[model samples]
Target: MNRQLTNSKLLLKPASASPALHRVLTVPQLWGIAVGLVISGEYFGWNYGWAVAGTVGFAAATVLVTIFYITFIFSYTELTAAIPDAGGPFAYAYRAFGPMGGFSAGFATLVDFLLAPPAIAAALGAYAHFLNPDLSPQWVGAVAYVVFVSINLLGVRDSANFSLVVTILAVAELLVFMALVAPGFQLKNVVAHTDSFGWSGVFAALPFAIWFYLAIEGVAMVAEEVKDPRRSIPRAYLLSIGTLVVLAIGTMLLCAGAGDWRQLATIDYPLPETLAMVLGKGSVWTSLFASIGLFGLVASFHCNTLGYSRQLYVLARNGYLPAFLGQVNERFRTPHWASIVGGLIGLGALFSGTTDQIIIFSVLGALVMYIVSLLSLFALRRNEPQLERPFRTPFYPVMPAVSLVLALICLLAIVYFNLLLSLLFVGLGAISLGLFWRFGRQRINVHLTTLGEAERH
Candidate 1:
């Protein structure tokens, strides 16, 4: 067995269980998923209220958050280009910290991915209120989950196509709304009305602002599917982040200008409400537009699940997870079972409660993963100087360091705002890490031994 374990084939060959699926996602589609998930107008209105009340200026806060996101994407693009693998942050963590760290990162990501679909579905359900206020939120969430899951289960090609369509419609709607409302923008609204520009408001608004800037790395999750990952991944990251920041600033300006900040703060769906007031009941178009945005959210959720499932499949093939999860659907040429599992998790989250709780939990988990990923970038650079890096992080250690710091700040803000809930999430991740180390290590060892025996013969 020792001799067999030394065999070059056993050491270097790819796992038989892992098969490359269709690479159908274009840079645009990747951008769509990243932007769509994070660029919700409703979230901005809901959370930015406090920011408006406390910050020196809404635009300044937007700019600060956007800069942080820009730094994050740069770091992510470099990492994704170096390791264009399915596991994303999981792959990075494994390379930098080892199996335990990898599993923790993957587990955290899974928590976020599992919660995202349902949270977005519930958000979509809320937007459905615009179309038909009587529509049951639960049912709306259920329907959206089913529809997107179906699209996802169909395979990557169809899912990417659907995402592209939703992205186009959503962007167009925002542009049109901006074009119509830009003329009515009032200069007075841009002025900071209160004396809330100190550390208190900045710290208070940081979490929600970070939430708005979240999901910028969703495209990195599908790094393997990108046609020219080295180039496309970075391009998509920049384009998506840039576009989202612009849209956010534009929407904030338009909404603030058209209506009082206090009024916008009180609105459940600020954009639509502002539009309705400015453009009349027909401006209720914000609802349809928001529905489109929700559609984009569903698309993003599907793509996210698809990307993460493939990551799990790779980890399973590596003996870090159950081997059964590594199996691919020969018929669909996708990770069908994993996709179904993701859908079920989303369904459960949808039934759990309101969108806010789901978003908080999902954000908490994602921030943990992001923090680890950013740290991994520095660790890998220090430990593996000879590693082939197709694309180096442009700002090198500085950008990644900044990203790590910002991620920590965001995590702290989450804890500060939602103390008990944040503690619960951290506790859950800690328990998961303990379980993976205690039980998963033994299984991986056994699998390794079995592979060694097979190689020896």
Candidate 2:
């Protein structure tokens, strides 16, 4: 009874005492942030799927992953609208479960957001290498980390506006590339390796397939910053998913059909190189397109930097991490320390692992988050029936259930294929949870924001 009374007191404590996050984002800006966070996948990571599954096998894997994201996003948006917290899944899981649940969700999300930047940074380096063979991609990626983190430190509004412009340019570049490559689309090239790897390879390709829409959920991490999140979240999510689906399928087909799919499967700058295949190595079109291709990579890297910092800031603010990370800059009202700290972690990851390894760890983290988040949705619906869900999920239990089941399947497939790495991931989770269980459990023993407060929002 004493513990319960203490928790109740903490729950009712006013959250306004903490510094306010700038609620300046609108629907268009939200859409840009959503799309921008995942655009780099189209540029680099998805091609690796082809390495494991061949063209047709990888395509099947991508379709399954796409179905998961579409259903998951529709269902997940409800939680975002209802809770409106910067911690994303961590906050939702806490309200649904408890401190242990919140820490679990936070840890998984941290892995996803923190690890993703280095993978994208590696791609930036690869694109740089493509542009100038003399440039070291790792060094170039290192420079990117510094530049974009500085941009984020400036402020959220400035950061988001940059995302909008760069996302538009990235989307335009993609459309143009598709237009140029469409005329040369060949069924023969696409089907050339149709049965080479067979059905088993499709399972092996699941993690790589996830790259197509890996960070789309990141939009939810900034929910506290969105203006009128109740109405804006659903609109922005719908638009973002539709745009990515079309782009993913169209880009894959065009690239496979451009030439032998095998040749482009291993490189980071596949789209530009695909154009080069059609237009020749020295063609002006290939040169200019490759130069502009940096926009898409830059957009994802920049937005992801924003996403991880928010994750770090919220975790710290809620007592899951060191309190220093939660401190906001008085001048910019941004999470300056969070951005810098997350970037430093990303750089360490960049040097320690290969691009493929980094991608697998990131996707693994994503699947864990998906599972935990879906479980939270179910628990919250049952226990907190009165929670003001601005956007209720379509089909309720069925939609969330489908997302949960698919997430389990993807998680199993990835573990089966990458056993060693999966073990390492599990080991890391265990260590973090073990430490939290021993040392700091009391620090976040109360719900910082009660469901009553969330419902009012």
Native RMSD of candidate 1 (Å): 3.6
Q: How much lDDT does each candidate structure score?
A: 0.68, 0.88
CA error at residue 409 for candidate 1, angstroms = 1.8
lDDT top scorer: 2
Cα error, candidate 1, residue 184 (Å): 2.5
Model 2 misplaced stretches (Cα beyond 4 Å): 1-18, 446-457
What pairs collide in candidate 2? none
Put down candidate 2 lDDT per residue, 312-350, tens digits, no spaces.
988777767777888888889898999999999999999
What are the models' TM-scores? 0.88, 0.95
Q: Which portions of model 1 show Cα errors greater than 4 Å?
A: 1-18, 41-61, 190-198, 266-268, 282-295, 319-321, 450-457
Least accurate stretch of 10 residues (summed lDDT) in model 1? 3-12
Best by TM-score: 2
Q: Write down the lDDT that model 2 would get.
A: 0.88
